[model samples]
Target: MTETWPARFIAAERYRRHRYAANHPLAIPRVSLTLDLIHSYAALSAEEYLVSRRASEDELAWFHTAEYIEAMQAAERAGKVSRASRQRHNIGNLENPYFHDFFTTPATATGGSIQAAEQVLAGYLAFSPAGGMHHALPDQARGFCFFNDPVLAIMRLRREGWRVLYLDIDAHHGDGVELAFRDDEQVLTFSLHMDTAYAYPFIGGGWRDWGVLGNALNVPLPKATRDGEYRWIFGQLWPRVLRAFQPDAVVLQAGTDILLPDPLGKFAISTGFFLELVEEVLHSAPRHPHGVPRLAVLGGGGYHPLTLARCWTGVWGLLSGRRLDEALPEAGRRVLQAVGWDEDEDEDYYPVLFERRVEAAGDGPPREAIRRLAGDLLEQHPLWRGMT
Candidate 1:
């Protein structure tokens, strides 16, 4: 009989206290809300929960520069950023504001990702919902990301000499992570995101921006990409890349921003499709010699707080192999009721967001544009050509 590997969830209560500014897209509670929903449904057992630690300066240095780390710390201590630090580190800017606990928040998230990587290395599947800040650069912040935890997590795995495949399905491109490993042959970075024409960090992530070592693949989908189109492209490309890379481990940036109703993303993806994607990754992840699959899952850009909480809670359920109650328990309903939403969010879906499962809408006809893009990718990409 095959032995079952354990699945662990890494989180920290500090997330509830450390939040971005009010106007920021990330200001809404995400990790905390998800945890509340999980607790309400009794989805996770005590043994499956792992408290996250704060990443040390040396650990942050794995991907971030020492100078940048010091600048962030100083800014955080003062609860503000100096003119010079703002210009140099891009911290005090409107995009990456200097908020309370600016440094500690990302550092803690980075530490959670490090823990997730350690758990994966030890033969357990791990999920870090507080991690996946994939837009921060080595010395600067961008796209509301203060630190690049996904890069740090991948770096942790690389320390063990593991060839890691970084898969990012966030609506926005994972520019920081892709750029960090662009020249490294041991790491393969694949990002399926909204086309730069319509998305933030509106550069690169195009077909022509394949990494220096041909270890990067960026699939830029058009806005309003529906479930069928998304799945069709993923089916054609994901397995092909997985086979070509043959990585020892897989790091998934499971960003719920790709789902429908997200203010930042235009994709029409649903919770059902999102769960299917996660299931595919779990089953297809490369296993170690001891028969344990090496996989680390991290959360990314999800703006709709209620939707994000529901999606991530479902993710934990899938990981823990729990049959979640479809109806929202009274406690779960209370949790959802307490969540604050922006004036821009549609209130019509508020009631259904309390439920554990959100069924996907019927898939529409496949788009010819998606078909053409997939065909070109398979025929012209260096990885695919080499495989052929």
Candidate 2:
């Protein structure tokens, strides 16, 4: 039996102090809420919780351009940006708006992922709930990500001479990370996201876009993709890639936006399916020579606060080997109740959201598009073809 590795949850109180501009998809509380839900369950012990540090300018320079970093800092300082800076760096725009602590907030998140990577390298299973800002480019921001923490974290692992597999399950394509390492043979990037035709960052997720060295695989799921279809695709594809690549470490971007209730996500995935995905990854993750699982999990997009909290809390429970009580404790209930829902939205489903039980969005046979995509990838991709 594989020994259970100690788990660390990386977070910071600063996340609560920062907020995106009003009415933005990310304006809702994510990291802070997940921290509360886990604490409500008493799932984390003092030893397992690590306070996140802010990424210094030197650290951000790992994946970000120095000019872009300075632009972000200037925007935050002025609460605005020059037209040239805005256009050049993609800051102070609708997609990547400026707010208080714009640079520091993402820098802190980057720091969390960096810390998680460090912990994983030290032979522990670590998670940075504030990480997985995968869509930010080296010189620009895209898809609500201002800094690409996932890229930086992967780079940290790469410096140690470890081959890293970056598995992104965000609803949107992990375009930034894929772009960063597509030419590098040491890092393999696999993304399963909503098809670009129907999602944000609307390009570059086609199954055939396998990277320069065939080290990248992009699987775009159709809108409203159910639990069964997701399982079928992941089941058929992930194990094949794992066997062929045999990565020394795996970085999982577990974005909860794929959940059924998320307004921004069209898929009907359930919390149960999400946990199953994490569990499977944990079970099959590769270990270091010292028998420690070299896995670092990061959070991505999840707009629905209630669902995000529940999903991430369950993830921590799984990682820490704690059985969460199905009945929502009063403390957990209060945490859910405290969320400020948009006034324009209906509250009829409010009661259901408080319940800890989320029924699985049942799976069906894979659709023809999904089937064809899987077949094509397995048969055409060099990685799979080269596998014995």
Candidate 3:
């Protein structure tokens, strides 16, 4: 057999065994659920299996302070929290509560992301479903994220001489990532998220938060934007960035919450459109914000279990270059049912959502929404000043 792109999957059954309590946003058995989906449906070859290993202390130190890791370790030892620890790092809190594997489980996910980036750098299209913890900050974590994996990966790639283009499609703003490289010119961050006032991580994502690189780009759309508007803004930002910096690698966080039924997000995008979006990324092979074209696609944040699985399964299949049959395969459906996810038979899984979706403001996109946003953004970026 021809040696295909060296694919890898970073997961451990142990990670699923040690999980958050049920009903919490982070409780779903992500790697396990995704594993079951692939086992039943995907034509995954042996090479794609890249089980996760915890990122080493030095790796964590790349993007996190020792004190932060110290705080996490201390929180782990006590099991039950004490007042002193609480005051130091806010260990046990409403949002980022202590979970079963609070200390190390997230590390596996972070490690997996780092591994994925390594494979991509080695010249293969790589993905780590456990990655995209974009909410974790260097000093602390919020929103069930303990460490920012993608940030760590970008920092790692930078040390190796690759200019990185960070793309986040999570419904919530990628505040942690944006903050980490906010001042560094080597990294260019692009985010399209639901407006902060209406979503979690509610403090940022303003287009004006342009990082020190003056390369940060934000498209804060109103709720209910569908394929057209979503594509428009992305269309605008991606082209200009490619023209300017021409990145060597692009890290995309494909969080599924933007789908219609996701509790955490308000947008009603379907999975089909997402496949096309990635397709475009490969087709254009943007001007290297880095030295070569590569990708590290990841699962950022999605609360709905089955929906998340369905959305990402498409991503995996797309990367493999196989067309999905519109009808869900029986074996795949059986796999989903094993996890108590019933099929929404009426739904279509390709090209467009079963329903004809619209943009935000309850009206479809205006003729110039894409041009206006892209035009406005380009006017301020350094890439436009001859970087490309």
Write down the TM-score of every candidate: 0.96, 0.96, 0.88
- lDDT per residue as tens, model 2, 33-131: 999988898888999999999988998998889999999888878877879888898888888887888788889999999999999988889999999
Query: Measured by TM-score, how close is model 3 to the native structure?
Result: 0.88
How much lDDT does candidate 3 score?
0.73
lDDT of each: 0.86, 0.88, 0.73
Which portions of model 3 show Cα errors greater than 4 Å? 1-4, 286-293, 341-364, 367-372
Higher-scoring candidate on lDDT, 1 or 2: 2
lDDT of 1 by residue, 128-229 (tens): 999888999999988888789999899999999999999998998889998899778999989999998778888774886787688889899988888888
Ranking by TM-score: 2, 1, 3
lDDT tens per residue, model 3, 285-341: 533333334887877888867667766766776666555564556776665556653
Best by the lDDT measure: 2
Which residue pairs does candidate 2 place in steric collision? 228-363
TM-score of 1: 0.96
